[model samples]
Target: MSSTTNYILGVFDDEDEVLHAVSEVKSKGIKIDEVYTPFPIHGLDTAIGHERTRLPIAAFMFGTLGMICALSLISYTMVFDWPMIIGGKDFFALPNWIPVTFEGTVLFTAFGLVITFCISNNLFPGNNVEPLDLRITDDKFVMAINLDKNKLGQDEITKALKSSGAIEVNVK
Candidate 1:
């Protein structure tokens, strides 16, 4: 089945106005699909009712995996496979393994985080997603409301946006 989705965009020139508009619109029991801004705004996530992200947890898990892999490789190569006795030390030398293990952990963590972020955000190379508004990337702050997701009529939503200092409202 093919279905069309409609979006109502509220454009604001100032960050403060957009922030205020978020609260004003939410107070009227409207659901916002997403907000686009030129730069990060402090406390905007909380204002928009977004939950805390679990990226830190994902980072820790990836780091742990890296550490395990590094340790395993060092143990196998140095202790079991080659049995190297460098600097008159034992085959399983902990001190010598420090540098390689650290490097491996850093490398894996860096790559893992990049892959995780890209996958989570659906950002892939050559993906041609259209922007809601070109000015949103430069100077404008846009609050997009999915018309199909909310029970309120378009006229009411538009009125709420206009009342909340929106410079312009457009439907797409």
Candidate 2:
């Protein structure tokens, strides 16, 4: 089945205006599709009702696996595979494993976070991008509303956006 949607893009010159618009729109019982801002604004997520992210939990799990791998590698090579006698240290040298284990933990955490973010967000190399106003990436703040999903008519939606401080509103 083919899907179709109508979106209204509300452009705000100031971040504060966009923030206010979000609260006002939601209070008016309208669902927001998305919002784009040039720079990260404090408290915007909470205003939009977005929940906290769980990427840190993934990072911790990856780091734990890395630690296990590092420990296994060191133990196998130094203790069983080829027993080494360096500075009269024991075969399973716990002290020497610290540096490699720390490095492995950090490496895995960094790589795992990047991969998880890309996969979770459906972002990958050479993916087609949806059309967006270039000015939104520079200075303007843009909010998108799915017209099909909103029960309010077009006129009422436009009025609400303009009343909420939208400098421009475009239908797409």
Candidate 3:
């Protein structure tokens, strides 16, 4: 779904093998497209040289937006629209709004991250992706390579992946 094509992907069985292979291959000047594992493995990003994620930035922006919206709504409702006094609290005191403001900020930030992640990855329910292998989501680890450069043929890439400690290497 990501327009990745002509890439050579090497799958691994053991997480350590993937980690060691990543570090070694990268040192040998070979580029990796992506790595996938059934569970999070430590230092996977570092070994693969992946850039830091942007989800936190998205969450912060959405949280700020939510805080602004909540503050504005509270101001309009308590001060301008209804001008209500609750338990002798001042009409515009921000302390009175801390609970709702905090709640809204967290809620919007979480939802924003989810939406951004889904949109950015193009992963949503009903957006069917051709599964590489069912086992990949269960017990196996997978690596997706983008081979648009057309530099290595099947045999050469296969040999490279096999030598890198891939338990099974096959083109799909």
Candidate 4:
């Protein structure tokens, strides 16, 4: 069982307005729950104090695992499973393993990054997304502030949002 929280969605028509609103609201000690934009807004994450992601490290780790598996499999198949000689190449032909190893590394890195992103963003299959506004995914930028958590009066919240240049403010 879970509880539903009430939020005030501050709508802004421009990215610059949203950026300014984030700084303004935070400066006024009003915590922003989250911000949604139709597309990536440069410097918005930084303005909102979001930390840098570490997905690249995850990709590198997965790629290393794939490379190790590929190398081991190639070496075992060629040298131990069934020894073979082709084009006067050595049984443990390291050069022959490069292409497959590279492919495996690339494949694992791509898939790993995708999985990591989905997991990190909580986008599992059958998951439902509660959008504050349909236009948020289309053209609008919205900032959500949890009223219950912030413990601010509705009038005060509305005033803060309006002062920060929000085009519209609505409760949800």
- What is the C-alpha local distance difference test score of each model? 0.91, 0.89, 0.78, 0.89
Summarize candidate 1's per-residue lDDT along 28-82 as a digit string, tens digits.
9999988999999998999998999988888888888888999999999889998
lDDT of 2: 0.89
Global lDDT for candidate 4? 0.89
Q: In angstroms, give how far residue 143 of model 2 lies from its true place.
A: 0.6
The alpha-carbon lDDT assigned to residue 76 of candidate 4 equals 92
lDDT of 3 by residue, 115-143 (tens): 99999998898998876656777888876
Winner on TM-score between 1 and 4 is 1
- Model 3 worst lDDT window (10 residues): 144-153
TM-score of 2: 0.95
In model 2, residue pairs whose N, Cα or C atoms come closer than 3 Å (at least 3 residues apart or on different chains), thus clashing, are: none
How far off is residue 38 in model 3, in Å? 0.9
Model 1 shows how many backbone clashes? 0
**In model 3, what is the error at residue 79, expressed in angstroms?**
0.5
- The estimated TM-scores of all candidates read 0.95, 0.95, 0.87, 0.94
What local lDDT score does residue 159 receive in model 2, on the 0 to 100 scale? 90
Lowest lDDT sum, 10 consecutive residues, model 4, at 1-10
